[model samples]
Target: MTYTAPITEQTFVLETVAGIGEIQQLPAYESATPDLVQAILVEAGKLASGVFAPLNRKGDTEGAKWNDGAVTLPAGFADAYRQYVEGGWGSLGADPVYGGQGMPFVLASAVQEQLTSANMAFSLCMMLTQGAIEALGAHASEDQKQEYLTKLISGEWTGTMNLTEPQAGSDVGALRSRAEPHADGSYRITGQKIFITWGEHDVADNIIHLVLARLPDAPGGTKGISLFIVPKILPDGSRNDLRCVSIEHKLGIHASPTCTMSYGDEGNCIGYLVGAENAGMRAMFTMMNHARINVGMQGVSVAERAYQHALAFSKERVQVKRIIEHPDVRRMLMTMKSTTEAIRALGYLNAAAVDRAHGESDTEAKREWQALADLLTPVTKGYATDMGVEMSSLAVQVFGGMGFIEETGAAQHLRDSRIAPIYEGTNGIQALDLVNRKLPQGRWKPLFADIRETIRALPGDGDLGAIKPYLDDGLAALENATVWLVGNHGDGFDDAAAGATPYLRMFGIVAGGWLLAKQALAASERLAAGEGDPAFLKAKIVTARFFAEQIVPQGTALLGPITRGGALLFALDEAQFAA
Candidate 1:
């Protein structure tokens, strides 16, 4: 089935979890007025629902064709790109000076979720362009910005992040790509970078490639790496010395080109440095923070898409007989619906934390929320994406044989979702970050206090008894994990990493349940006033309870090893069973 952008759920999430216009009350976020945000969302949704949603299945089936130096996207992509540009959706959250709409990243974050969920492959072009725009905005010289950011922001052109060399991968310091500095303050870049999304496409007049290379005298490892902007089209509209060497035949996200980019083959790949030479890592980080959050959004998007499809499929296609006159298929259908909604709540809460971190006026308040964002970012990226892929698989199962057929479109969601956990620094890395950095930061007491304080602020009325019990259970487990980390920090440091993946998942389930409950209460308030849909509001509360009853209970089981399981992993013999 073709995807329908979940506009109703998204609108509810924004008004409830994201709490629009609340941010506007702060001086730092004064620009995030509800009227402005609503207007931007409406315009952005037009592109997502009207332009991209219709083309999702077509793009997947047709994919992108690569030949020589050019890439031909699926038939409707170029038209959609033109529509995105016309609507200003491409640059909605970009820096203001570059002719972008200057919307809040938080506001755009949710909209991006809908677009990517509606169509991942197509949305990638816009996603990558945002990264390149940030790189240029943060580090590019005035001339570079004046010449590049404006058009890129206007969606007249596109951008790509070129960091993965065959040898480098995640180890940027191991890269062999060379950059020879010329007398004209430019470098002649040479070598190959692979997995470059939208490296070559027909929709834009120019493609800006932000690449990493090493200077001759530079120190070894990452210290030697430098960032450079190598455009596909020169300032004079001439060809630059970079070509799409070849595109990969991937298992998933077929519509997005993952090209092997070869630079300086003609010895004319002149590129300007951004920021200081060899400080490329720092500059790249600016783009990484933005990309990391956006990548997390991919998890949210796929999960929502998968959930909707599964729910729709379960309701219409009866599997087991009805139980007590109510269809048994309805029971399975409810599980998919409830699980998906819970995941959606988890994702939006993560975004809200990010926005609060950036917008809160209080320094201490900012630190607290920002730390919460840091803690959840990895969980959101790793757990949510994993859930998305799994959810898509379940949807296929629910659809039975028809779902396996290519024309049904359920399989593609699973395929596309598989890449998210592997990208944006991978789930393993996110897990490591969660354990090594986020878990032990600023001592555990402060984070514990923050949670307790938040719980204290929640409404203490009759309807919340269910939430209180769940929250208590979750909080108790969290405290146990916290105390173990703090008291035995060093004892477990060398032997606890094996459980990192489980640790993140445990975090996500409990935290997600909590967010779901909070959202339920907010929804109930609207329902009481006859403002929002009662089904939606009731759905929030029911799913949250189901999550607590069935899902949140797993954290207790996962705790035994997460704090001290590395010893077992290290204990495995190197040649136990060589395959």
Candidate 2:
């Protein structure tokens, strides 16, 4: 099935659930008028469907090619990237001083969803580049910004983050890469980094690498680590002492090269430091936080694509009649539909929080919004990604035997989505961050109060009313789980950690239901006033009701496991597992 952008659904979620109107009221985003946002989305959808979607299958089949030390993308990828650059898609939400369009992040997020849904592998290059732009914009020196920001924002060059090594996967402090002070105030970097996405490619003029390495007199662990800018091509136009030793042959996203990068193989790799000495983690988090949210969007993106694919197939494929007419198939489709919408709502809502946190001028409001964003970040990343995997698997199940085959393309969605929960910090880590870190910050009180207010404000006598009871139950369960986890977090860290995963899942379901309930209210009001498309608005109400009835209860059901503690989890001795 050909990919089609769900513009109507996205716009509805943006305007109704995410409060784009309120976002635009901020000084930083006042220029993001509704007409301009619509124009941008329309053009982005065209680029996604017309240019990128066609390459999805070929990218999977052909994959990226690696020669002696160079990486080449699948056919037509370079051209697609060129179109992306030429159209200025990468400049949205970037700093205006650096030649960016300076659009709101929420609007840019909506555009990214369409792009990622069209071709996930192909969209990864842009994602990494944007992350680099953010890191440099926030941490790099004035000279560094002048040199790199414009080109990176304009898509003339691409960027990467190098954090992993053979022995130091999640334990970044264990890395052995070295950076020694040079004669000209620069540093000489020497290390072998792995799992570098789009680390080396022929699509752009140069690849800017943001690498983490330890200095000569630096202390042991992450504190001593410093961030460096190691470019494939130096300022003097000489080839830097770095090369792509090899690229990994992955399970999916085959078109995007995952390279094992070798720096200073000849012992002369040039490097420039970013930010203060021994403050790499702080700088890296700026990029990482940006990436974490985008990864959550990736979950929404792949799930939406999978749903569209499955829904299209169900309508076309017939056994006795159209598979969509079958009760079982219809259930699967509704599960996919309602779940996708819920996550999309959560993801977009999180994006709005980011915008408010950055753009809000009021000190107290900004702090609150930042706290809310931090709280939602982990839940959005963890729950949406786990659901991304489940939804894609269900999409494959809709095709039955044909899904297991390579030609049908359903299996690839599952394979591609599998990495989201692993990268950008694993979902387990996200869960722990949610319960162990965010919960202790005391931010959940205001957030919970807001959810309760929404529940109270929901009318009682229509479709919106149907959502109130289920949403209230889910919120109550979340509150109970939050109180239990917070109590255990101080003295029983293990117990809190043990239940963190389910706690995050429960939180996501409740948050998603709340956002959808808001959307349902908006849709109902529009229907009553005879505004907008009746059919679309009606579908919105139905999808929201379906989620409240079918999915919200799952949040309530998770409360037991969340409060069960860690005794059972640690009951078995490590060495006795085989027994």
Candidate 3:
């Protein structure tokens, strides 16, 4: 709000709700003390607030220029890119063995909030590059990792996930990119990949494209798919056979290039295998654990941006006064604040769970925490992005006429945040995964119990007394919906198809409310010691309270539809209207 990056709110969540302090005991994470994290964040905030953020409007207005084969990015993007890499922010959470800082994922995630909030389109290159680095780290040969991981991690080069093809979008099974075996144990890839981010760029030395292709005699569909390290440069280190045929010219994030890549046009796109044959899906997914969370943060980041602008407009624009403070405008303002705060808490909570899972050394604790992360990742991505759109809309309402003007940046927030729900497996897909994959997957009941116990361990206090009851109710609703799903999941999933989105919404409220409660406890501790900022701590309590009392009720209300609403989902009477 007040057109500022919610850094104070963010730190409160990390230190209080997410418990960044507790993370220090974790091995490899000992360096990320609260003080160090604060120092990193303070530096990160300056870049976010000053360098990247000032360009949001410019990027949107100027966009990226595509002429012939080269795409010229917005002004200062190159400088920001250089600074980001030099700062080692790219490899903060990566293995120290590869020249990374080896900070906890929690800190990296927190810092990323500022990055994307500043400018998501510009940051997409960094986000995809990290995903490629991760895939190489997990599945690439030692030689491959040595050659690629350092620069990619250092952000000297960017990366892309080349999954979507002409025929395949959400359906991975429809991919037809081919990888042929060569004499030198490498593979030659020939394919046309569409919707490739940073497919070719001058911001970095090389563009690493993790192209998915099918090997000869490989099984059909997704199983046949293999991941390849198709660099724009040759193994002997010359330019290769990939071309950015064209860049997409629509929608938000215009500063980022979305290319159609033509691989092996000259039979020269030598693609090296990262993992074993046909294990491409496994290798691709290695990056997903964090990639999903990063996309979710985009949702959080843009929401904060939109909310900040909206809140500022509401406070300053004096159209009418004192309907005891213009109750109508006040309602719009309050809704914007509450929705953004609720979803922000959810995203931070998801980040905290990820930190716990990645940072914790104890095997059992790790598994349990990982389960919580699994549960919340989809919710954070789905609900938070949707909230961003809502919050952006409210920003427009507050600004009235000016919000409609593109110059105000209010309209752009809505456009940019809209994609969060669509991408990262779509919100609907995320919902289905929650109900069908997570809840009923073999003997994983312990997963739910693990989360519940950890949540309970972080108890509320007298001030938090009002928050607990609804949180408890929300948790119960989650339990009931989970049980109902396990019992009634239909064969091939057609009967239960329609409730996916609502289920994800239910999950977000419970998961977000839980994280806020955890933060509330930590804030109370900090308040007692007088170590935290009072305004932030107070906002933390209020936001958490608002979510539990006002928003968490959705979890319970959703149970009615989950239990008895499936038939209506498919009752469209196909013959009713012949257009």
Candidate 4:
């Protein structure tokens, strides 16, 4: 099945539900007019479907090749990258002052979804560079920006984040990378970084590495860690004393190199400090947060691809009749469709929150939006990724025995999606962040209140019928869970932590339902007015109804685990696992 960019669907979400109109009204995003937005979406969709989608299967088959200390991407990867750069797709959401188009990230999110769906392995390189651009623009010195930003934004060069070491997976403080200061305002970075995505490749002129290392006099742990710009080529046109010693053989996304990098083996590798010493964790997080959301988009991206593939397969595959005629197959397809749309909606909503947080003039409004963004980030990352895995698995189930074979391409999606939940912070960590970091901010009252009011404002049975009650009940369950988590945080934290994963899932269920309900409402109003495509609008209504009926109920069940699951979780002894 050909990968078609869901431009119409994405546009509906953007304009109807994600508040792109309000985003346009904001002076910061004045360039994002309706026409411009449409053009960008259309062009991006073309690039995704025409160019990137074609390489996906081949990339998976050929993968990236490692020869000596260098890595070569799959055939056509370099040319496609050249096209991506020439088209200025890399600079879409970057800062304009440094040669970026300065598009809103919401639009970027949509484009990224298309790209990832079309060709996940190929697009990983671009996504990492985008994260690097964000980090550098936000934290790098003016001189550093002048040196690196334009090239990075223009895609003449690429970038990587090197925080993970052999000893340090999620524990940044445990990293053993070192940075020794030099007299000429630079540092000699010596470290072994592992699992560095797009860490080494032939596509770009230079690869700028944002590495985390401890200075000699640095105190300890994460507080002593510092971020440095370690480029493959020095500014003076010399090779840095760094090499990609090896690239990992991964389960999926084989076209993208995941390298084990060694720095300063020959001598001291020159590196430029990014921010204040010991603030490496802070600065890296700037990139990580950016990467996390993009990872969520990755989940949405792969899900979309898998869903399309499965939908096509079902219609053509006959089992007594077309599999599409099978009720179970229809249910599976509905689940995949509704879940993908829900995740897409949540991703866009997060992007819009990001725009509001960035563009709003009022401090309080900005803070509120920022809080909302922060809250949703974990849910989006964790829930969407978890769903991506499930959706892909369902896609395989739809294909039955054929899905187990590589030739059908269903398994590739499953493989590609598995890494998302593991990297950019595990989904477990995301859940912890949701419960311990995000919810602790005390921002839930207003958000929860808004969810309730939105539910209340929904039209009655005439318009929504059974959908209204399902959504209402979901909100009620979510509200109860929120109250339980918040009220019990003081005395019930242990249980809360144990239940964090399900709580996050519940939150996603409600949030996705709420957003889908908003879309359904929009479609309902448009249908009543007799102004839009009746088929599309009718489908939207049906999808939303299915989500409310089938998915929303899961939120209610999570409340028990959220309030009472911790003791049982901890009941098992550390040694009991061996039994």
Tens-digit lDDT track of model 2 for 377-450: 99889999988999999999999888899899999999999999999899999999999899999999988998
TM-score of decoy 2: 0.99
Q: Can you tell me which runs of candidate 2 are displaced by over 4 Å?
A: none
Instruction: State the lDDT of candidate 1 residue by residue for 23-124, as single tens digits.
Output: 657665677677777766676777777788888888887888988888999888889888888878877777777797666666778778878977898888
Ranking of all predicted structures according to lDDT, beginning with the best and ending with the worst: 2, 4, 3, 1
- Clashing pairs for predicted structure model 3, backbone only: 17-519, 322-325, 323-326
lDDT of all the models against the reference? 0.77, 0.92, 0.78, 0.90
Q: Which ten residues in a row have the lowest lDDT in candidate 4?
A: 457-466
- How would you encode candidate 4's per-residue C-alpha lDDT over 516-559 as one tens digit per residue? 88888899889989977899999998898899899999887777
lDDT score of model 3? 0.78
Better of 2 and 4 by lDDT: 2
Please say which candidate is ahead in TM-score: 3 or 4. 4
Steric clashes per prediction:
3, 0, 3, 0
Candidate 3 vs. true structure, TM-score = 0.93
Model 3 segments beyond 4 Å from truth?
A: 1-3, 322-324, 442-463, 490-492, 528-531, 577-579
Distance from true position, residue 345, model 4, in Å?
0.6
Q: Which number leads on lDDT?
A: 2
